[model samples]
Target: RDLCADFECEPAEFNGAANHVHLLVNLPPKVALSRLVNSLKRVSSRRMRTEFPEPARHYYRANTLWSDFSFAGSVGGTPISVLRQYIEQHNRPV
Candidate 1:
């Protein structure tokens, strides 16, 4: 979305249900995973609360809409086909 584009990142894939989101992104080499995740959560949460009042009501008083922690793995040297297959087979059902 706008935030991703603004950060010079492209979200290549996204899928999720009610309570979670999965994003596969291609980010500029200058962006660190920690910073990128923090920005996404912070900016998106702010936008959500401001622009979507009704849904924002469900958010807790804490200044957060997503969990503070995230899971990440290095994909170095891994083929896309192999990675996708592993993710689809073992991760999709999660």
Candidate 2:
């Protein structure tokens, strides 16, 4: 997918049905999160429009696919081991 290819990252986790998609990416520290998300959104939207005009035309009828705001945080104090475990268990069967 363009998201994986363009970002130089792999989708660590992917699970969704019908309307929504959830993705987890283990990206490199060098990649700016904001820049990466923005680029993915911009490029993907454009490509989708070119490939599927109908959906693209009404895609933003609700105003925008995403809001003008986003949430971000650093795991500075979290241990690598702990973080990995947390991510791994995040969406696992309960």
Candidate 3:
């Protein structure tokens, strides 16, 4: 949430499962989505590595903590409640 605020975005909902996370953020038109994602990955990766050096070293081979690709979509006419439920309930493969 703090991270989103730093990028001028509001995190409507967030959840993590398996190897991926779901985040429904409200972004301003001027904010670059790619930049925000990269910043989030960089900051979190650095902090996590500092807190858990052994796991970071053991699990990562090329010092890469995040994938290069990301998915972005508009809420459009969807209800916020529905989006929140989906994020909270959906699980991904490891």
Candidate 4:
């Protein structure tokens, strides 16, 4: 979706648990990590509120959804296959 159009990266895998979501994306070289995270949070928050107004109203009080803090890391030096396997294994069932 937006990730594909905006960053030229499609999410390879996605999983969500109680308090967090895990996404595996293949990012283009020019994309900045912080910018990507901010855009994702902003866009998804807005879209979620608009598309699911009842749920958004029940859960959130403000216009924003995500917290200000985020965690990010580079996958450099790790084999892609191994990383994919790791991400696949760690996901919690919905």
Question: In lDDT terms, which candidate is top?
Answer: 3
Which one wins by lDDT: 3 or 4?
A: 3
Q: Pick the candidate with the highest TM-score.
A: 3
lDDT of each: 0.70, 0.61, 0.81, 0.76
Write down the worst ten-residue block by lDDT for model 4.
Answer: 85-94
Better of 1 and 3 by TM-score: 3
**Model 4: residues with Cα > 4 Å off, grouped in runs:** 90-94
Give one digit per residue, the lDDT tens place, for model 2 in 1-94. 6676677876555543334434556677878888877776677667777787776676555645544565544556656666555555545321
Deviation in Å, model 4, residue 50 alpha carbon: 1.4
After superposing candidate 3, which stretches have Cα over 4 Å from the reference? Answer: 91-94
Q: lDDT tens digits, residues 48-75, model 1?
A: 8789877776764566678777876556
Consecutive 10-residue window with the lowest summed lDDT within model 2 = 14-23
Better of 3 and 4 by TM-score: 3
lDDT of 3 by residue, 1-94 (tens): 6888888899888787767888888999899988888888888788878998887776565767767677877768988999998988877523
Count of backbone clashes for each model?
Answer: 0, 0, 0, 0
Can you tell me which runs of candidate 1 are displaced by over 4 Å?
A: 77-94
Q: Model 4's lDDT to the true fold?
A: 0.76
TM-scores of the models, in the order given: 0.69, 0.56, 0.84, 0.78
Q: Quote model 2's TM-score.
A: 0.56
